[model samples]
Target: MKSDVLFTSHATAKNGREGHVKSDDGLIDLDLTMPNSDSDKKGSNPEQLFAAAYSACYDGALNLVASKEKKKIDSTTTADISFLKDSEDNGFKIAATLHIEISGVGQEEAEDLAQKAHQACPYSKATRGNIDVTLNPKAV
Candidate 1:
C-alpha cells in the first residue's frame, strides 16, 4: 500500500476579510486573514501556509536524502522560508526561498544535500513546472 496521510480541516469567514481555520485534531488552528495594506491586521495568510509546509517537507526530505547518501547531519540550527509576491496574469504569484542549516556538514556538503532533498521533497514535486522554483543550493 502507498504511504499516505489523512487530514481534515475547516475554515469560516468571521467577516468579509477575516477567517479562522482548524484541523480535525486541533493541532493546526489559526486565524486567517487576507493580505492588506493594514499592517496592524492579525492572522496568517496562504503564504504562511506555503512556507510552513515547504520548510517541514524540505527538512524531512533532507534527512531522508542524507540517510541515503550516508551523510550525517548533526542538526538543523536554523531555517528560513520566505514568500515573495509578484504580478501574475490573474493577480499575484507566490515564490519562495528555503534556507536550512545542516550542522554536521560543511557548506558544500550541506548545499548538495539540500539539492538532493529538493528533488525528493513532495512539496517541491507538487510545485514543479507550475511556478518559478529556484532550487538554490540554499533553498531546499
Candidate 2:
C-alpha cells in the first residue's frame, strides 16, 4: 500500500550540531547548535525546527477535520517539544505537548476535533507509540 509522494523537501546540514543547515528552497538557512544555558550564540536547533513543523502540520490537520465536519474554526496550535533523557538507550529522546485553542466552539467539540486531527496528522502518525505526545484542546 504505497502511496505516491506528494512533495519532498531537501535540506543539508554541515558539522553535525554546531554548523549550518540550508534547504533547497533557501527558505530555511540557519546555524545549528545544541541547547545551552550559558552560551548566547544566535542559532537554531533541531528541536525548535521539529516543533515548528509539527505545530504547523497539526494545525492544518485540525482545519481539514473541521472543514470535513462542516464547522468553521479559528484555531491556534502550539507544540511544546521537550528533549528528555532516554534511560533505555543512554541518549536523548523527544516528547511533545500540543495545546490547541479553537474559537467559536465548545470545549467538548474542540477536544473531539483535536483527537480527530491527531489521527489525521502525519506527524502524529509518525511519532505514535515512539514518543510521548499529550493533547490539550480548549475552547477560547
Candidate 3:
C-alpha cells in the first residue's frame, strides 16, 4: 500500500470556520468563513476550495486519459459541491456533481472519457467511498 510520492503541498488554517488560511508558498492565502446565505462574508469556505481543486484535478485527469487513448480534446469541468447534514452521524457531509463538457466529441464519447477520468483522478480516488459524486458529461 505504498507508492512513490511525486509532490506534496502544505497549508495551515486557524480559528476554525471564521479565520485565516495560508499555504506555505503563499499562493493560497485567504480568509475563511462559514457558508451563509444571509450574511455578506468576504471570505472563502472549505466546500468552495474543494470544488475548485476537484474541478481542476478532474480536468487534468481527463486530459491525461485522453492523451493515453491517443485522443485530443478541449474540455471544461465544473464541480458543484454541496455541504449537507449527515443524519446518521449528526455531522456534516459533502456531495459533488461534476459538469464535464468536451469539445469535438459525441455524448457517448464524452461520457466515456469522463467515466474513465473519474476512475483515474486522484481526487476521485480519494473521495470514492467517502462521498457521493455524480458525473454529467456533455458534448459541446
Evaluate all candidate structures by whole-model CA lDDT and list the values in order: 0.69, 0.95, 0.94
RMSD, one per candidate, in order = 3.9, 1.0, 1.1
How high is the lDDT of residue 46 in model 2? Answer: 88
Model 2 Cα lDDT, one tens digit per residue, 1-140: 99999999999999977889999999999998888746677799888999999999999999999999999999999999999999998999999999999997899999999999999999999999999999999999
* Sort by TM-score, top down from the best: 2, 3, 1
lDDT of 3 by residue, 1-140 (tens): 99999999999999977889999999999999887846677899999999999999999999999999988799999999999999998999999999999997789999999999999999999999999999999999
C-alpha displacement of 30 in model 1, angstroms?
A: 1.4
Count of residue pairs whose backbone atoms collide, per candidate: 0, 0, 0
TM-score of predicted structure 3? 0.96
Span of ten consecutive residues with least summed lDDT in model 1 = 75-84
Measured with C-alpha atoms, the lDDT of residue 64 in candidate 1 is 90
Candidate 1 ranges beyond 4 A from true positions: 1-17, 75-90, 136-140
- For model 2 the local lDDT of residue 95 reads 99
